[model samples]
Target: MTATIPAQTGGDLPAHNITISEFGAMKALAILSQSGKENAGVRVFIKSGGCSGYQYGMAIDDRELDGDTIVHDRGVKLLVDRMSLPLLRGSEVDFVENMMGGGFTVHNPNATSSCGCGHSFRTDGAQSPDGEGSGGCGSH
Candidate 1:
């Protein structure tokens, strides 16, 4: 199934749903088709460990586990597990290209801070003991 979400600007995201940009969706679709996983979905999740208290993860998955929230935007499917939902609510999945390289990224409204690599983040309610998360982004 597919869903059409209205356009939202910075800080104006839907309170309970995750959204994907046009560019992001296009790129994701291309990747999935190229990988022969056109029927699969991208799974987005948050896990303990990163430069921050929590790290972001994504994968091309064909199975939907129990308690998974499936979102379809612009022909691309995004799967988020129940345990990671609260922290990822209202986030945006985007793809960026730069001189360095290109990759998928999460624009999370719940994050208070993120690592330099943008793969890790800390939310208001998940602060570390020193008020900061340790370890380099390269380690993970």
Candidate 2:
């Protein structure tokens, strides 16, 4: 079960999108249910300045913005704002477990280079702010 939410066009909003795997969908549902909020959902976004030029941010939210792309899957809603959609388009949200632990992982196809941690990534040849190494979620 794979699903994608594409940002709307012809509006004063940004256009970006994201996909989710079955595992990710189920995990989102579980998390939301545990939060005890009837309208709780996950908000995924991108912020500037990581080890890479951009970084991912996520949190459980109950409010919906004016220009949010909502992906409904497995009884869970994943929200992506207009400004953050473009950077996340074609990316996949997944959940995995390892000896270290488990969490949601985003497989972004737009990434040109990523760090060893798989949390932060670069899409173009953009350099880090310090002109040294980039940092973020990890890498992909």
Candidate 3:
């Protein structure tokens, strides 16, 4: 989650995933543009749902509480809520523009299992496979 990314330039656009360009950052910018809010953002997190165990939820909001962790990437800034951060610690969110399944995808190394629907993932207790889920996995 604390990966160090070199600064971005107007010439070199930042990147989150190979398939989808600026997954979270682009989504954040898009949300800001629509809300017409100067400092708004898109928040991505996992919730207890779907056929598996957890599902990805995204929303556009213009509010920031005290315990939010912000990830600034590719000229776009995103705010991840405190509660949600635990489950999504080291996940790399990607945007996949595919005919079969095209949308923002979370490359969660923590998840032990992910449903075939590309949503809902489950991880072991405190330890994920890759140890990225230092915050522990969310429960249903």
Q: Candidates' TM-scores? A: 0.83, 0.77, 0.66
Worst 10 residues of 1 by lDDT: 1-10
Per-candidate count of clashing residue pairs (backbone under 3 Å): 0, 12, 2
Global lDDT of model 3: 0.59
Q: Which segments of candidate 1 are over 4 A away from where they belong?
A: 1-14, 129-133
Worst 10-residue stretch by lDDT in candidate 3?
A: 12-21
Give the Cα lDDT of each candidate: 0.80, 0.71, 0.59
Say which candidate scores most in TM-score: 1
Taking the tens digit of each residue's C-alpha lDDT, what string does model 2 give over 28-138?
Answer: 888888998879888888776556666677889987888887876456678888887777876777888889998887889888977656666778877764553443443
What TM-score number comes out for model 2?
0.77
Winner by TM-score between candidate 3 and candidate 2: 2
TM-score, structure 1 vs. true: 0.83
Query: For this target, which candidate reaches the highest lDDT against the unseen true structure?
Result: 1
